[model samples]
Each structure stands twice: as structure tokens, then as C-alpha cells.
Target: MPCPPAVRPGTPQWARCRAMYTSEETAALLGFSDGGVDEVLINEAHWTMRNLLLEQLDERAQMLTGRHKSLSMVEGVQHDDVDGIAFIGYHAGAGMEGVLAHTYLANSITGVWVNDVRASEGLLNSHVVAEYGVPVVLVTGDDLACEDALGYAPGALKVAVKDHVSRYAAVCRTPTRTAADIRAAAREAAALATRHQPVRGGPFTVELEFDAEHLAMASTVVPGVRRSGERKVAYTSETMYEGIRTFKAVTTIASAAVEEQYG
Candidate 1:
């Protein structure tokens, strides 16, 4: 997952500027091979979901690239054999300070809460994978993102590639330094990959706060979602699988309703 420039004017800039970062991160993860790990599936979860450079990855791993995935960010976790998952190049949630931070909708979403707890994409996806009995073994990101992971996957190994100064600025480590650290951590994290009984931590409640009132109003178009406040909508589901689906639907519908100039 590449971190797009905060003020890039077009896709070309993003492609030229940010794509290499994610590739380097992906390469660092290849060190997991030393821990008796057989395969690695890189799910493209960023904007457009096609940021990772395929040729840059180690040949031993296969990547899942594109969009319209059933599980979205944690797309491959539905498999019964997946013992662990990792959050690579993730950022803090919307309303938090980290580079290119947001939930599903980059600008419209203000906050997301799961079971009355503030959640990032990591937390929400962590709950989703839990239902499938897969542990989140490692998380790599900026300092704040690693701190955020502590709330959901406390026992998982964490690597901070940068230190957040603001949403756009970060004190970054050079690729050589970060890659060495990430590879070593991934090797250690591999030993933590152990599946457990599926967690039925539901019925789950999800609440989303939007940056605009119109976005909240638009979210109600998703059947179960209703306006919970002037700029908030909430929904509940019997399981997190259902919960994430509804959340995706709500973000989709709301994004469509955004007014280009005013939003």
C-alpha cells in the first residue's frame, strides 16, 4: 500500500512519487520467508487498490490487486487456512494525524467507531479477521499507526517506518534502515502466527461521523443506516462480516452524494 502525496494533482504524480515506498515495504516483508512462512498475499487496499509494484515484490509471494473485493482491506482473510494477517503501510484513521489518513472515504469520513470504541481501518479489519480465526501478526506504519495497532492487536509485532509530524509531514527513516528493521520484525512476527477459535464478537454496532451533514443524510440511503446526529450515522449487524459490508455500502453511497465544489 503506497502513501499518496497529500496534495498531489494527478495520478501520475502519485504513481511516480509514492509507488516505490510501498514496494520497498513489500520487499522488506519478504524476510518472513525465514520463519518457515510459505506464502504471502499482498492485498492492495489503498486508493484504487493498485499501488503496489508487482515486479518489485519477491517472486515467492503472490499479490491480490484490484478493487471490488468482498472483504476489502482484509480481502484474503476469509480463507480458512490463513493463520495470520498483516497491516502494511497503514495509517491512522480519519480525524487522526498521520500521512494520508482516512477510513474508506478519504475526505468525507470524519470518524468510525466499533462497539462504542473508536476504530481505525486496522481495528475494524482486525475484528473481521477474528471471525475467521486469523491472528494479526504484524503491523508496519508510522509511529501513530503502530500505537493505534496496540489497541486492537496488542501482541502483534510493530514496526514504525516514520514518525508522524502531521497528516502530511513525517520524520521518515531511510529505506535501508527501515527495511532492515521491518525484515527482522517480520521474521519474529512469523513465529506469532497462530490461529484460534473464531470469535463471535457480535452483534456489532458501527457508527460513522462524516465531515458534512449531507454525507450523513446520504448514508441513510443504505437501508440499515440512519442518521444518528447532524453529521453522524449508525448501523448494527449480527456479525462483523455483515457490519463491514454495511459500512462499505454506507461509504459508497455517501461518496457518490458528495458535491464536488462544496464538499
Candidate 2:
């Protein structure tokens, strides 16, 4: 059958296309029967954890397929209509133990912390959504990833489809096993679907510690970001909204300075 209509451009529907499937699975898990699930498919980005094949997706989904979204992976969480989020295909943060572990720019960042909590992209985005009053209801990844979720999303359901041996290897489940697990978890997570009052936990202080000093030095070019020590940069903002944006800028600058072989 033909895919569901593409999310309309320049509208909130477009934004819905970019939420992680974990959110959709949460909606499904929690019994959101009234059009609550939307799927965003990113293209051409192969870090193994990404590159979701649209054709293989179940019929209940509507996919946003293409490239260059402003917020990238967690694109839809900011929308007022989105109630909760889920982190599907999510691994551990860079420097943490999991399969295909890394944060935003893959290998460039060694670690990121918000209010001193080590953050995965899921964890960071979870904090971002909390500012908007959205709950993370489900998370799926390796065993370590599920453990990580407990620290950030304690109430959320988690399914570990694999056991991590390294960044590139895992004791993986068959697709049949994993898919059933995801579907069941998605169904249950839907019950947690409900928005609450927006949070304003600002001024948020974010600290980034990179593997190299040059990366930290490069991040300092962004105004208000300053070196905290040899390989770390710190920045504060009035809100997590602003804090995350500044964090994005710092990562971008740091990523650009990475040497091909030395970094």
C-alpha cells in the first residue's frame, strides 16, 4: 500500500514527522487510539543506529522522509500537540557502554551533562521536552541503554533488544522478537500520554567535556561559552530552551575542529 500522506510543509504536521519512534511506540503502548502516532524517517545518515527503512514499517505509521531538519532527530517534541516522546533505536551516550554509542555529532563529543547528569541524546532531548512538559514514556535499545533510561526516564517502559559487546557489535535479537517487543511496549507506553504544564528550569548550566582540548577551545568561540578547564566548556542560559540551542552551537563548532585521524 502507498505510504500515508507526507507531513504538510510549513505546518505543525511537518514537525510531527521528526519525533523518534519511541514516542510513537509510547503512544501506541499507552493506547492513543486517536491519531496520536507520527513517524519521522531520517535519510542517508548511516551511523548504524539510524537509517530506518520506511518500507519495512507497519501500516499504522506516517513517515517524514528526507533530510536537513532544524532540530534533526528530536524534531517534533517542541510542537504543542505532541504529548510525550519515546527513544527508539537509541544507544548510550558517547563514552558510555552500549552498541553504536555516540551523541549528536557521533564521535566528536566525549560527554555531555545537564545539571551534572550524563546525557544520551534521548536524555538531553528528554530534558528539552520537559521544558515543554512532555514525558518520555518509552525507550528501546541495548541493555545498558535501558539502564541509562532509568536515570532519566524512570517511569518509562524499556525494551532491550540486544546486549552490547562493543560500539560495533551486539548480541542482537531476531527482527521478529524485537519488533514484537517494540509493539507491545509501544502499546503500553501510550497510557502515559498526556501533557502537563510547561517547565522552566532555567538558568540551566550545561557542561561539555570533550576528548581533546582543541574541541573545547573551538566551542569557546560561541558567545557566552567559556572554558571551564583544559578539555571542558561551560555555558549557562535562562532556560533549557536557550541552553540546548547554545549547546547545539558548541557541538557544531567542536565538530568542525576535529582532525580526521587525531581526533
Candidate 3:
């Protein structure tokens, strides 16, 4: 997940900027408050789930930082009181064209389909939160990611921080510029956080295509995952909550199966 000067962990231009992105977004949404909103929960969803720099955040907000969260990226959404959620720094699904795009396993997974739909992390997580009546209120990422969100969170405000040029390259905007755009959009997004009825959009099937054949066979060790092709595995669950869990298990298994250098 660390790509040196271009996308390394501490560089402000790459990974560190996401902390600023999330903080500014939080500040913007809360700035609109008239005592209507009280708390802001920022969850770390990036690699290791510890990428966000806590000191950069406003005092009014708290972050969920750690790994092995019960719900993973959408961990905080399980509570009935959560009205809305946002997908920030998300990219296109695996096999799609977007900056640093990949599904859960990053490389082993070449693509994922949720109930016959090509699904990004944003799309998959959106379905998971829908079970709890939390709407996706805003999404911020590269241009392709914004476009990807259109299918899963159509009404949610979208802010593209950069234009995708390739998987590792983008026509990026300065943080100063993008922050302003995100701040404004998030302020507006705060109004759309109202909760709705819980959605039971499932009896879901998840299909994953891997880059290697061995990864496919390895995934089958996870219960319910079966080989669907030479390099693909499929699983079904009654709800997206279960579906996402199974998907995580499959990816973890596939990750372990990948051979170094030759993979």
C-alpha cells in the first residue's frame, strides 16, 4: 500500500492528505450545526485502518482507529442512532479505472460482483449500512470514484479530489483547493443525514474474481465460497451484513495464498 514518494504513508501529498481531507470534511459538517448535530465519528477505513492522524482532527470529533472492527469500514453504522454515513477516499472497484483502485485484497482480487452488479468498496459498504437505515450522505474521492458512487448513493453529494489518469496517477488538485470544495459539499451534505427505513435488499450473492488460480482454490476453504470459474469464487448470504463478512473472509484467505514476486 506504500508506493514511496508518490503514495507513501507520511507524505502530505499522498496518504497524509487523507487525514486532512477527513478532518476538514468533519469541520465543515459541524460548522453548519445549530445544535442539531452533536457528535462526529470518523472511522479509519484505509490500509491498516490507522492512516488518519488524530492530532489533525478537531476536538469535537472522535475517530475509531484500529483493525478487526466488527463491521470493518462501516463499523460505526451498526448502531440504530447512526443517521447517515460517508465514503471518503474510496476508489473504483477492482478491474475498473481509478486511482489506486482495488477491492478488499488489493491485488489478489481482480473484481467483485454483488448480486450481479460490479461493486466498489463504496457500493458494498453502502449496502451494509442500508440494513441499519443509515443513508450514504456524501462521498469524496477521485473522479471515477465519484462516478462509481452514483450507482450506489445517487443522491449523496460527491466531491472528486482528482481526475483519474491511471491506477497510480491522477490529475490531482491542491489540498487547499480540494479542501475548500469538500468543506462546502460536506456542509450541504449534513442536511441529507436524516435516517430512513431499514432496507432489506438481499438474499445477496457475491462473486470474486482473482488474479491467480491458486487464490480461487484457497478462497473455497472459507465456508460457502465455491469456485465459480478457473479463477473466481462465489458466495451467498441472506443480507449484505453477512455478505460483506463472507467477502472479507474470502479476501483474507486469498491474500494468504498469494506467492511473493511470482504472484
Candidate 4:
């Protein structure tokens, strides 16, 4: 209903995460709103690749993800080197009412918690960036997504490109209007990208609840992860960095264990 009651705020610091396009390094792109990314001159490659990635994940969850063969999100960027980050096209966490609501997996994971706080990708990522003093400066998505951002990035600029009607439907704005809205928000958001002291909130107890009992059992393959209940598993990480990586592992294993029609 409401953005996970009193979820602990993570990385609320301000910092600059510059999105440099082809030739112009200063030109800012507002990013995705509603179902698709707002078509921008620089968004062509990014948008296409994003769709491809999503298709791959949805089609082949068992094949593994960034944490494996290819560069993962965590390994791709130097968290310490980043000044800030942007969470564009975010949605509510799994089990919440929002567009295509799910955590890392499509439908396997029912919930994710950090320090026992029900967390969305934005919240989990905000904590990751916070470890290196990177503040989340801009978050764009549906109205609920914008509302979710308030808990994690209270200072970051928010733009709701659409109003959620159902998991698959929304009252979307014209591409023209959304682009303009995101552009203005991005401009202001850039100024909020001022880095602050790195947060060392650790000893995090990361937990995941799955739809099937076997998925929970499968997650135990990861080191230090153990079943906390009938359909839930939990792990402890000293840092959010490791926490995310482990979470990724758990999801990968659990998804790989999925049956075609049953899962």
C-alpha cells in the first residue's frame, strides 16, 4: 500500500552521476517513464540493449546473469569511483501493487529484505551506492515508484511518467510531455548529485521469500545461506555489496531449479 512502512533510508547523500552521451558529455537525458524509455537521441542504443537484456532475463533466467560470465552491475562500475546514481524505471518490490512488480526474478521471489526492511530494487541499490558515497539523484517511473523513492532518496528529484492502473496497464502521458518532465527533473537532479561520506551499514541480514518450497531449498546452495522457514531463506553479509551478489546467486540457483509449467 504505502512504500513499505518506515523502510530504513539508504544513501540519501547528494552526488553527481553524469550520463554522457555520444558527443556531448554535458547533455542530460531524462530517461524512462511508463512502460518504455522516453525516446531520446542518446537512448537509442541504451533502450534497445535494455529491452534485449530484459528479454534474455525473462527467457533464460537459468542461464545465469551479470554476476557470472559477463560483467555484473556491481562489478561493472567502481562503487567508490561513482559520485551518484540514478534509478530510472523503478517499480514496487515483489508482492506490492505496481507494474510488473518483482524483485530480481520474474515471479520466483515473492519478497526481499535488507536488515529485515522490505526493499525494492531502488532501496537495495541505494544502499549499494551509499557504500561508496553515491547518492541516488533521480528516480523515474510510475507514481508509486516516485513515492517509493521518497523513502530512499528523499532529496532526489522524482518524476512520475504514468499512473498505475494494474500490473500491466497504466494511464501514461504522451512521450512529449514525459520527456519534458523528465528533462526538467534531471536538470535539477544533477545538482543534487553531491557525494557525501560513505555509509558502512553492515552485518546486513538479507532474506528472500519464494513462491515454491524448492526454490527456497535451492537457494541454500549459496554459501552462508540457510532456510529460515518453509519457503524462505536468509543470509548475512557484512556489506551491501556482498549482500546483493549473494542475493543474485540465490535467485539464479532458485530460478535454475524452476520447472517449466509448475514454476
Candidate 5:
């Protein structure tokens, strides 16, 4: 497919963003064709390595290697950078009815909330990026995932590649159809990629519901996280930056606590 001319904002500022899963196709479809600036693809190690070797990529990419980065603990985004972002191949939050639904941990986490609003990864990451002035321009996933996004990035274009029939199954769409729809949406969504002033909404209270009682107890190993119930833990952070990383820690410790045949 031929690339479209770059989309421009009123000012000279360029766009930078992040995405994951099926991101290879999403990245190729967007790249500099949809938005003017380069994209920062966030995928697992294997996909990133494949992207590096294929040369199908347009500008440099990024794989969010965790912890102790020179700038941020996760190399997903940098402050004063990234104008817009997209969530690709995301699903419903844990305990939801979407296909392959789960939060950060596959089965350990049953639910998560930020200030009492039930949060999916889309909502949580949206909060993290808004702090740096980044806007969410596009989101692609199952229909429920798109519905879930309305709460987080209602202004962004949402493309539902499939309709959920169950947690592991959906009335899937043809790749050709989805690709065409996404391409159209991506092209139009480029205009929404402009950056804005950073937002500072502080004192975010994050709570997690685990599948097992032990998982909640394990989460308390992270400082500031405490037992909220037999299977829940809660913590408060002054910023989403701290809140997200702390959430990561809680999930990790909880996952490690899982035992075979006993959750």
C-alpha cells in the first residue's frame, strides 16, 4: 500500500507514540504515513528483534525493557516526548467477558481500580501518558475492549477487529477487512495526535483484587501496599508514574507467590 502524506498539527511539533501486540502490522500501517513523527513500538523481546531484522520498520523503535532505565524505569515513553499513543490488540480487563481477558497478570489479578474506577490496561496507561501531555489517538481490539476504551480515550478512534463471544473466543474478522478499517482509522486519527500541557492529578489510590488469598499477602511485600481484604491489596501514590510501577511490583510479587494446583 502506498503511504499517505504526513499529517500535520498547527505548530511545528512532531508526534511520537507507543503500541503493542499485532503492533508489527499496526506499526507498518501507521509509521510516518499516518502521523508525521516516528512511532515507538512496545512489544516483547522476540517481536522487537523481528522488527529490527525485517527492515519493515520506518524510523527506530522501542521495546519497553523494565526497571532501572536511564530516564524512566520502563522505556515505554519519556517525559517531554510522545505526542500521542495507541493501544492495539488490548482486551477487556480481568473478570470481563472479552476474549483472552486479563490485566497485567494472566490469572492472578481479578480486578484493579484507580480512585474507585475499575481500570483496564488502557485506562491505567492512559493516566500514565496524560501526565506527560500525550494524548491517545487510536485503540484497536475486540468490541468490548473498544467499549472499555470509551471510558479512557473516548476522543480517540476505536476499531473493533472482532466481537467477543467468550473469554477465549470471538466472532473474528478477516485480516483483510480489519487491516483496511484500521488503515482508514489510522489515517484519519493522525489529526488527533497533537500534544498538550502535562496534567498532574495526584494522590492516585490504586487497589488490586487477586485470585488467591496468598497473592494479596504477597503483594504487601511492596512498601505502601497493604492488605485491603483476604484477596485484595491497596496502595496510594502521589502520581501515576509511581502508581504504575508500584502496580507492576505488586503483580510481580503476587505472581511469584502462586503455587501449582493451588492458585
Candidate 6:
């Protein structure tokens, strides 16, 4: 899919930015026609300053837009036909330095771990896709985000569009400069796109540490979830697919339990 072209403030530009870059630099590298891909867009955020810049996509690509998807942001990766996945407009995880850093939920999750490593969304999704033998071909974001990708997908190409200073700020590159870098990187990344062995790492035990006691207690509403400590809950599953689904349920319940004034 072509990356969104219109860069907006405080939003991750994932595919949009990548599309701009690929159009300019990497179009020939991946052996894809200059403009031949489809985009499935999802609006997982509450608000943004500008709409995605769709105009930048080459004539060969098409887009899907709107919100409320079953898989949330990565709705397209699971499709059997998708050859590779790209992490675009990504950022550092919660408590890390990068623009708009957070996991699935901005304030609810304190941390998420994958195979005992501190994970950002890119890392988590990388593991999820690996289960289906999908390659993560390109990652674009702040420098730290690229660094995070290295832990999960070292073989993929990376494009660092900015240098992190704080959660909400960065020393950013202009769209023009970043586009050039991303295009070139993506072309090479495309070469790494072949899928490999499907990985199965489980019976996984997921532990979620909430910021408050009530949040932990609330998570127990999920059938197998249990409070493991004063402010922590844990659940076990036979596969990461089930593990992640259960983790999602726990987060949903915990988030609803949060009180505005005290939590």
C-alpha cells in the first residue's frame, strides 16, 4: 500500500509516509510497478489535525479508510495474500522517547513484553505476523523506533524520520528528506520480503501490571485472568493468538475500570 501523503501533527504516518518515500526512491527496488498496490486504512486514533495525504500515492495504488476494525491497526497483515508488512508512522512504546509514543492504548498500558523483551507495537505485531510466516519488510519512524525494530526484525530495512527528544517531540526531518530515505530503504526492504517458517512461541504467560489496584482487580473479569500481585494480573494461553486476544480483553476491562480523578 502507498503510505499516506499528507503529514499531520501528532499522528503516526505509517503507510502514508512510506508511500511518499517509495514513490520517489524505492519504486524500482522492490520490483513493484511504480504504482500498483492496495491500502487498507484504519483510524485507530480519536483525533488528528489533518487527513492522510492520499494524493501522494502513485496512480497504481488504491486505499481503504475509516475506523473500527477487528484487528485494529494491522488489519491487513493477516490476509493470506499479503506478502509483506510494513511498520510506518510508528513510534516508541509508552514510557519511551519518540513522537506520540504509546502502545494500543495511550494511557492504560504501563508496559507490554514479548518473549520477555520490552515491546513496542512494532515488536508485538512483528511477533504476531511471524506466526503466519509474514516478513516485516520496512519500518519507518523516529530513530528510536528503528532501534526498537532491530530487536524484533533485524533483517528489515529502516527509515528514521526523526530523532527523539521526548514523548511528544522530536528533531524531525522534512517530508521531502524523509520520503527520499524511506523510498530507498523500502526498495531494499522489499528484497527481504519473503516469508519464512511460521513461529509458535507459547503456552504463553502474559503478565499485565496496571497503575492501580482497582485496574488489576477489574481485569479478573476475564475468565482465566488472575491478580498476581497488588497491582498486577496474569493469564496463560496455549498460543500467542489466544494470548493476545485474552490480553486485549484484560486491557479493555482494566481501561473501563479506570477512574478519572484517582486512577
* Leading candidate by lDDT: 1
Task: Name the TM-score of candidate 2.
Answer: 0.79
- Runs of candidate 4 with Cα error greater than 4 angstroms are 1-79
lDDT string, candidate 6, 1-263, tens digits: 11122344344554455455445333322333322333322222222313344465445454444554445545565667666777766877865666677666666666665555676878767767787788888777889999988988898888888898876567988777776677677656666667777888677777776667888898898999987888878878877667667766887787678786752
In the range 59-117, model 1's lDDT, one tens digit per residue, is 87788989899999998889787888888888889888787678877778889998889
Q: Weakest 10 consecutive residues, lDDT, candidate 4?
A: 14-23
Model 4 error, position 213 (Å)? 0.2
* lDDT scores of the candidates, listed in order: 0.84, 0.70, 0.82, 0.64, 0.70, 0.65
lDDT of 2 at 93: 91
Candidate 3, residues 1-263, lDDT tens digits: the string is 33434345566675655656566555454643532567778887776776766777777777899988878999979878788787777789898999888887667788999888999999999999999999998888999999999999999999998999988778988777876777777778878889999999989989999988998998899988898999999998999999988888888888877787662
Question: Residue 223 of model 1: what lDDT?
Answer: 88
* Superposition-based RMSD of candidate 4 using all C-alpha atoms, in angstroms: 11.0
Q: Name the runs in model 3 displaced over 4 angstroms.
A: 1-36, 261-263
Q: Count the backbone clashes (under 3 Å) in each candidate.
A: 0, 14, 0, 6, 0, 12
Please state the error at residue 91 of candidate 2 in Å: 1.3
Query: Per-residue lDDT of 1-263 in model 4, one digit per residue for the tens?
Result: 21221111221221111111111111224332221323222111111122212231222111122225221443433435545556656788888888767786767788988887888887887877788887887777789888888988999888787899997788987655666777667677666666798898998998899989998988898999999999999999998888888877887799788888642
Clashing pairs in 1: none
- List CA RMSD, all candidates: 2.5, 8.3, 2.3, 11.0, 9.8, 5.8
- Candidate 6: regions farther than 4 A off: 1-57, 261-263
Question: Per-prediction TM-score, please?
Answer: 0.93, 0.79, 0.92, 0.75, 0.80, 0.78
Q: Over the stretch 92-162, how does candidate 5's per-residue lDDT look in tens digits?
A: 88777787777777777889988999888888888888888888888888999999999999999988989
| 240: Cα error in model 6, Å | 2.2
